[model samples]
Target: MPLLAGFATSLSLIIAIGAQNAFVLRQGLRREHVLPVVLTCAVSDAVLISGGIAGLGALLTSSPLALSIAKYGGAAFLFTYAVIAARRAVRPGAMSPADHAPAALRSVVLTCLGFTYLNPHVYLDTVVLLGALANQRGTDGRWIYGLGAVAASFAWFFALGFLARKLGPLFARPRAWQFLDAGIALVMTTLAAWMVLPAH
Candidate 1:
């Protein structure tokens, strides 16, 4: 029951559309460094969830300064990515998934890391929320609960990254790629604004 609860909770949180998901989806569609990107996201989640279960979440929640730093840094990064996406949208010729030169593996990995680590919400969701929930099951059950969350992360990333190729046909058109990039730009910009703007 604890395991199921953990899985459900983690999935619910992760299923939300956000910067990380957008980046993963883009990489998956391009079929460029898909394995590395998926593994990076899944492995990062495992580490974050584990840390949360071990009480890092509590530590993070108590530190306003740390949260602020993440908030600003993440916003800046998201904004920069949004500009890049917007530029791509304007130049549809360069948007073809198959025609463009593949991005360097190092650049892709670094961007993946940025999306994973810079986002304050990632910490709040994985470390603080998941950790607190897991710990509620007590020592013996907490690790089991955490394992379930980890499993969900792996399953979701693999499915999202691998299954995304099925949409290759749809994105074959430059117009479709333009639309996708436009949407990505909107989502990234909105998220960045949300992060920096004062909460209601």
Candidate 2:
């Protein structure tokens, strides 16, 4: 019961539309650096979820400085990525999968790291929220619950990154790519704004 609950809860949190998902979809569609990106996301989630199970969530909440640093740093990175996506939208030339040059592995891995770590929400969702939720199962059930959550993470990332190739037909046109990049730019900018703005 705890395992199923954990899987459902973790899937609910992760499967939502977000910057990281958007990036993964884009890369998967392009068929570029998919393995590394998927692995990075899954591993990051595992580490974070483990930390949460270990009670890092409470520690994170009490550390205002750490949260602040993550907030500003993430916002800056998002804004930068937004600009790049916007530029791609304007060009709309390399949108064709056949003509596109694959990005370097090093750069791809770094960007994946940034998207996974720089976002404050990742910590909140994985460590604080999930940790607290898992602990609800008590000591015996907590680790099992956490294992379920970790399994969900692995399943979701791999499916998203690998299964995205099926979208090849839909994204074939340059216009489709333009629209996708435009959407990405919009999402990134909005997230960046949300990061800096005061809560209501």
Candidate 3:
């Protein structure tokens, strides 16, 4: 029962669309850098999820001032990303006239890096909060909880990236790109606000 509960909770936490998922979907729809982006996201999540399960989150949470800094930092990053996404929507980017697409491998690598490192939200939610949540289950259930979280990350990333690629052609329309970019901006702005909320 505890394992099941933990799994459910973890799934719920991960299911929400967020910065990482946003980047993956965007890249996938562009069909610019599929494998590298997918792989980087998966690998980064694996490492952070592992660290959270290992209880390193304790140190992060131990300092109230540090936590505040992290939250504010995350908020700033999200807001900045929101602006960039909006700009892209208003002015969509294109690959070089000669090149078919932005170097797929490099693009994916960089996007993944941004999702994992630059986006402060990733660290706060995945590392600190998830770690704290895992610890609540006690030593016996901790591993199971961590497993569930890991599963959620893997399942979501693979499924979203796969589906997004399939839908890439549909997004080829100019209006579709606008809609996606707008959606990205909206999500980022909302998340940024949420992060800075009083109770947050």
Clashing pairs in 1: none
The true-structure Cα RMSD of candidate 2 reads 0.8
For residue 36, model 2's alpha carbon misses the true position, in angstroms, by 1.1
| Runs off by more than 4 Å, candidate 1 | none
lDDT of 2 by residue, 159-199 (tens): 99999999899998998999999999999999999999999
TM-score of each: 0.98, 0.98, 0.79
Q: Write candidate 3's Cα lDDT for 119-159 as tens digits.
A: 65677667877777887888888777777777777777777
In model 2, residue pairs whose N, Cα or C atoms come closer than 3 Å (at least 3 residues apart or on different chains), thus clashing, are none
Write the number of the candidate with greater lDDT, choosing between 2 and 3. Answer: 2
In the predicted model 3, the residue pairs found to clash are none
Q: After best superposition, candidate 2 residue 89: deviation in angstroms?
A: 0.5
Query: Lowest summed-lDDT stretch of 10 residues in model 2?
Result: 92-101
What is the C-alpha local distance difference test score of candidate 2?
A: 0.94
What TM value does model 3 have? 0.79
Candidate 2 stretches with Cα past 4 Å from truth are none
